[model samples]
Target: MNHFQTGRVSTNKNYFLMFLGRKGDSMIEQEIQGASVAWFKIAELIARREREKALGVCRLLAHSFPDRAYELQLEGDILWALEDTLAKDRYTQAAQLYEHNERWVEAIALYEHITTIYPIDYTALADLLFCYAMGNAYDLFTTLCNTLLHKTQTGMLSDTNYTTIMHQAQEKLQKYPTSQHTAWVNDFILWAATK
Candidate 1:
């Protein structure tokens, strides 16, 4: 039985509204309509191993909100649990959506996984570097900068892109200095400027 049917809680929306007393009517409505509750329900079903139900909810959510990255991610999660190869593509699509929204941290988390499987993916590597720099993850940025520098020297990374990335990295270093990497960055900047 449902919580309300079991006499453990009221079915009245007012009962829940009491907890959000200061949130106002519109806020409460928005919170409900925003799919936070539905997402939680689906997450609970997934946790309980109700795989079919969770997949159904995921498909419904993705269909209802085609532009929502989280919905696509949720659908991908369900598909991944079912061992579907297309799940990876779904994840990439969701990551692209995050990138378009300029949500660097989220995009980086996904790109990091994708790049591990496709290490020579320069496009993903480049975007991942940008996200690292944007998030002030200086240590990761330093590592990626060195990798790009190596690639540039080996003619793997394009000269034009390398110059652009090096300049961006130099500006990032100046904007958010890292104590341990300072000398390395300085040397790279000098090398990059000369090239």
Candidate 2:
């Protein structure tokens, strides 16, 4: 007997989300702002300690705005607050989403968060390295690259991740030809090549 209903959304969550997904681009864009408002309001519910309703809102948010990842940090926070083990998974997924969307800074932040929370999440470390490099956070990039190599001296890094790391670093190598990190980048590239 709940009462929150709108022109396109309804209590039947899946149906509402389906409608939105199938709608024309103009309508979807028009509703983005409204959905964003609803997204933030869920934070208020969590702040008020309305756990059940907040969870409901979170489900709606996940379904209705699957592609809109701006609220992922909030989602991870809410899930963490609720003692849900899926919190870290959500954070990692958010990082991937940020990466896919090419929001490098946000992706880096999320990856950093994931690594701190799950220090053994080697994939995150790999992803973070490439992101820091591509985003021109050269200081953090080089620092983490050295740290990762030294720490994983026992060959713990997977081959796929190594290739990914190499590709990401090499893709942007020419950008800094005259820079101080030039020799350093080439040195690493040659090192990776020999490996």
Candidate 3:
């Protein structure tokens, strides 16, 4: 279950809130500290092109904290990098596999990683929002939508670009509507339509 379902909001000092409730106090503390350390180690490993070690850390983080978006995103990034390292141009094919296979969770994770590195990338942002909606990650989707809308209002995002992305998002929503999160998608589209 997620934080809302458990009725416990995280109080971790880290920017990425942890979901270590089931691990007990001592273990939770140890895991949190380990996660912090692993984050830096994972970055170093990725920079060094040490794919196996980075993948190990990422997989551990993802399995230990399934609710942590950052961990999932990192796993997706590491997997993408590994694929690209092994094959010259298979990353795109892998992404398409995730999308076609209805693995919205993995797709969202990859897009989240991409968005963090390229905040102003409209295409990635649009896909990220769509995947979030598909996976019922409403909170992340709403937060990103607000950020993009703010950028558009401030002229940081061109009108054409904003419209194009929003239109693409709408098409995705319509094409593969989910019963659960589609309400939020509709609400978002209505708001965007008015704007």
Candidate 4:
């Protein structure tokens, strides 16, 4: 009779463990479904130009899935939109967000990313170059300048190309004043003149 009771007790324990396991799995599934719903709501808010609400949703998603690249990118986009809509200093915040995600290249590139869509955007290019220099990617800076110079020669760049490149070089010189980067930029300008 004692052996029968021990067997029954063991069976009961096994059943309890299986029940708990199923419960845990169901909870995880429910949480994932909740997260998906939240993400959908965020996308809706962003599309509707409800910037603050969208940003709040992005923040919550970011917190929930700290390592998710899509969530991080959404957060960055929200910040960018906020900056644009509010006419605020969004570049620094965007750069910080990229940095937090360990996307140093993108962050540095943003500092100088320019579109010929705006004739006066040379300043943005200069800013990007300075950021790259600050990030200690001297090789990348040199490569970019060379590429731009080549594009100008090929007539691929707009008529404003030469002035823009020169302006960028000069701006970088001011930022790195007495550094080797300044000297390098100066030398490149001189070389361009010779060519």
TM-scores for all candidates?
Answer: 0.49, 0.54, 0.51, 0.52
TM-score of 1: 0.49
RMSD of each candidate? 10.4, 12.1, 10.0, 10.5
Summarize candidate 4's per-residue lDDT along 44-68 as a digit string, tens digits: 8877879779878777767766555
**Alpha-carbon local distance difference test for all models:** 0.70, 0.70, 0.67, 0.62
- TM-score computed on alpha carbons, candidate 4: 0.52
- Whose TM-score is greatest here? 2
RMSD of 4: 10.5
Residue 92, candidate 4: Cα error in Å is 6.1
| Residue lDDT tens for model 2, 9-70 | 44465565565575555676667876787768777887787777876777676666456565
| C-alpha positional error of residue 153 in candidate 1 after TM-score superposition, expressed in Å | 7.6
lDDT of 1 by residue, 108-168 (tens): 8987876776676556665676567666677887787777777888988777877665555
Question: What residue runs in model 4 are displaced by over 4 Å at the alpha carbon?
Answer: 1-40, 47-52, 56-76, 79-89, 96-106, 112-120, 158-161
Enumerate residue pairs that collide in model 4.
111-128, 112-128
The residue-level lDDT of candidate 4 at 24 comes to: 51
